[model samples]
Target chain A: MKEHKKLPSAVIKRMPRYYRYLTTLQQMGISRISSRDLGNRMGVTASQVRHDFFSFGASGLQGYGYDVDLLRQEIRDIFGLDDLFSVIIIGAGNLGHALAKYSGFEKNGYKIAAIFDVKPEIIGERINDIEIIHLDKLQEYVQDNHVDIAALTVPEIRVLEVAKLVTDNGIKALWNFSPIELLASDDIVVENIQMIDSLMVLGYNLRTAEAKLNPN
Target chain B: MKEHKKLPSAVIKRMPRYYRYLTTLQQMGISRISSRDLGNRMGVTASQVRHDFFSFGASGLQGYGYDVDLLRQEIRDIFGLDDLFSVIIIGAGNLGHALAKYSGFEKNGYKIAAIFDVKPEIIGERINDIEIIHLDKLQEYVQDNHVDIAALTVPEIRVLEVAKLVTDNGIKALWNFSPIELLASDDIVVENIQMIDSLMVLGYNLRTAEAKLNPN
Candidate 1:
């Protein structure tokens, strides 16, 4: 119950994937999962699953494995997601709007607290209950709401500039959708999403699987 | 080069990461880089770099290292990105739009051939030269343009449905940004872009670094 205990970001990251898999099992009305079963979801070995789960002090039993609901709660607590994070949206572009009204945000203990955009065309528009504020109002919003994390869906050319604006306003983390890398001070963490690298992997994997099947 | 000559998928996956590191060196005007430098960028041992590079036919001088530009080109060619890939975007949501208009996509030989959306609201919208078309029109576009790969950025609830539509339309590979597990047939491959997992790893590394700095 310690207030400021930090989960290793890597552990925090895997928590979501694990959460996704567990959610699938939960949807199927499954009550228990061996670490191997969890690993099978991501094409990883069961030992790898046990090792990853060990980092969070929850390990599947040798015979009984893990109680799906209990493991999910333990992870939720470790990731500081037991309470919803007040997440603001920066850059009310298509990406920002989709994200602001995204279904997954609420599911993962995140609230789209505010939406910001510099464009006059979209400044006052609302996505769901959240209104789109001008980017000029970012500092005020961040300070007033004590915003801790933001989703940067801005133009790649301005990703760093906007990142500075977000971090300077006392934000500690960001879910960056910008293609370019955002260089941040050690205090603030930024995650870049690369689409092509992902696509290439899928293509290569498919090709590899086909090759394996037809080894002539 | 033979079109169907399949490289190891693991090699293909890591190529971009190594390429990014080399590109960093190129930006710094570092003409040559040692395998150790690549290893450091990847958080792997220098010997591991030597081992992987050997597989790639990087039989360079024992003392010196790889030419950064040359190695970069080789990596690009190995990943089959020396030429542009005809790519498409499925789901005109936040992640999809960000991907369609991403500069990194252009930089990496991925050209957005089309964008598909099921929502009637987005069907006529445009991201760069790519116009969003309804899912009903996807097969036409894929057959006409021969879009080699598709990126799935739909929500979890719609991920499987959209993936099925894309693959059914002849998209042999998919880059899934949705935070859900996809069941791909043997003929198609799906790779989930788990950004949270990567960020978690970064977070864990940061924690380890912090622990080393402030060991109690």
Candidate 2:
């Protein structure tokens, strides 16, 4: 990144949104997109989009707007998507299996290096051609293979224990699917996603909208 | 609630975290917790926790702090979690099947009404006892059954088409897993989970943290 200042977490979070939308535009063969049009599609104001772009030193011509391909490339680079990361899924349950088969991560610079599970039945199994190895081999594999991230889809009770194993083995980040909230050191980053929390947000919003529609 | 003003989106987003933590505390048999302790567990400041509670008209005692059960109940009520939302998965893909089998939703207000897909092969299949029905039956099922949310795990190309079908059928909220963003009307809420975006965030953070640890 040319910009010396560290971007805020919120801004960093929105970078992938821009990357996704811009990639779509690029695929559709749209050569250019104005801040206004991009913001409209992204559900943000034009000035907000311009300001966000400025944070990453992405500039647009006064009348012409941003070049679609260049802008997408810039955002992708900003996200460190240019670098490939070897990822390991820590659990071989349904969620883990689904994530293992998800092709989106490979498309966006994440390569599934291995999958670890305690279950002997699934340990040697393969999901979408990615082998599920025993958890005993996790630390050794991570150390030897230089795994970048551990995506934990283990049950809530096993989160802390499994997290310790991954973090101890030099995993710099965690995409946690378990409901348990993890405490990370300054060098380690944890993105704890409680899927139910998201569902609750949806439920709450749905209720409010329902109320507005029929206030009985 | 009692506060006539609608809660801000940021506050609404935090409600689930609060609910989750409090529920954990409640399960641990911890009946009372001060804002400071709660904040410590939640990675926020005591004052910030207090402020968030106040946003929903939840007040902590001067010294005794908040009642864990009471606080959890209040947040649950705020999230409108007392009621159940009938949910349907739009695609019968791996992710969709995983979500269908995920028991967390039923434990927290979201009940899987059914799973829908265009594929004829999987139409009669079942995931966690929920039937996978034809996508053509979605509109009629939703209309007659009153589905509160549609969890879209469809392919990128089919997202817009499937989203329109659900939204038009009065599905109030969408938990979209597809990479493509959905445009929702004012009355409908869309929680777009770009899983790749989250993975990118983890990658970016990892790179930055790695740089800090071993600077070149």
Candidate 3:
């Protein structure tokens, strides 16, 4: 892979969306797609699509458009999706169970290696054949396995301590679902799934759309 | 509330983050905050914070900075959170159950009015005191009640059909958790919670951070 300069955060955020659209096209057996068509599907202008692709060094043929498979592969490489990532869930609550039972992540090379919780009743149970271990075993498990990501589904009160334990054990990335914001070291990557925030945004948009129609 | 111009999409997206941070500060009894301090907490520049607030006509005092409660209330009003929104879950699976059990949405005024499922076994069950109704009853339920949002947690195969049912019943907003993107009408709002996309971004960031450290 070429050593490309770091793309802007906006472009980085859109890469996964592009990858998803391209995957859909690939699955449909469409080998090529015009920028205009792809952009329409993605709710963006053709020039915006072209600019995003250009940032990543992908150029379409003048008349024939871009190769679906090639563009998907390039995005896959950029996201390092070709490699398998071992993920451990830090809480065995409903959200944790949902993540463990979700088959999408495993299909995309993100394997749920283990799940840990402080509750004794749920510990030792299995979700998708992966046993839920006690929180006490987290450090030992991280040391024994090559874990790439720690998905923090713990409660807000316990999330900070759990994050510290994970980072202390050399985990470099955190996919936090906890309501609180985590302050992690610069080297560690934290991706917070603020579901409430998303809901609030949807609410705002719905209100905006309604106001436009009523205008009262 | 005074009428304001439609904020930029980028600013609209960041509103929830600002709300979250301000909520935290309010809980901490921090009545006033400088743009620099708020910006640091949100991982943005002070000017960026100022710009977003300015877009919404929220101007901070030159010497005293912003009032935490006032800014949060402004954002809440902008998001229309003062009014309770009736929400229904479209699937009774693990993801749906998680959404139904989540107390955050209700705390923020998005009530899970009911949950619907096609399956016979799980249809009548309760999650967080909200009864799961049969999917066949969805149309009747929507007609009887004013539901603002339908949280789609059904499988990808069933999502489109369920979405069609929800929209056909006049629900204007969809909080979609299914992997597939739902194409809604121009006036309807669709917020997709693509967990896989988020995981991929985390993976990419992890890879980039590791590459910076090890350059191989």
- What are the per-model DockQ values? 0.43, 0.66, 0.74
Q: What is the interface RMSD of each candidate, in Å?
A: 3.8, 1.9, 1.4
For candidate 3, write residues B1-216 as lDDT tens digits: 235577787889989889888988999999999999998987889999999999999999999999999999898778878798888988887888778777688668788899898889887788999999998888788778889999998888888877888888889999999889876578889999999988988888888888899887
User: Which residue ranges in model 1 land beyond 4 Å of their true spot?
Assistant: A1-13, A183-185, A207-216, B1-12, B27-29, B36-52, B59-63, B93-95, B118-126, B195-216
Model 1: what TM-score for its first chain? 0.87
Full-model lDDT, candidate 1: 0.71
| Total clashing pairs for each candidate | 6, 0, 0
lDDT of each: 0.71, 0.83, 0.87
On residues A91-203, what C-alpha lDDT tens digit does candidate 2 reach at each position? Answer: 88878978887878888888998899998877788888999899998767875787889999988789898888888887879999877778767988988877887888787
Candidate 1: tens digits of C-alpha lDDT, residues A162-201: 8888777877777777766564455666666665567656
Looking at model 3 chain B, report the run of 10 residues with the lowest lDDT sum.
B1-10
lDDT (tens digit, per residue) of candidate 2 on B1-216: 221246888888888888888888988999999999999888889998989889878898998999999888787777766677788899888788778877788778779989999889889889999999998887678667878789998888888888888877877799998777776677988888778888888888877877777676
Question: TM-scores of the models, in the given order?
Answer: 0.84, 0.92, 0.96
lDDT accuracy of residue A58 in candidate 2:
83
Candidate 1 chain B: minimum summed lDDT over ten consecutive residues — where? Answer: B200-209
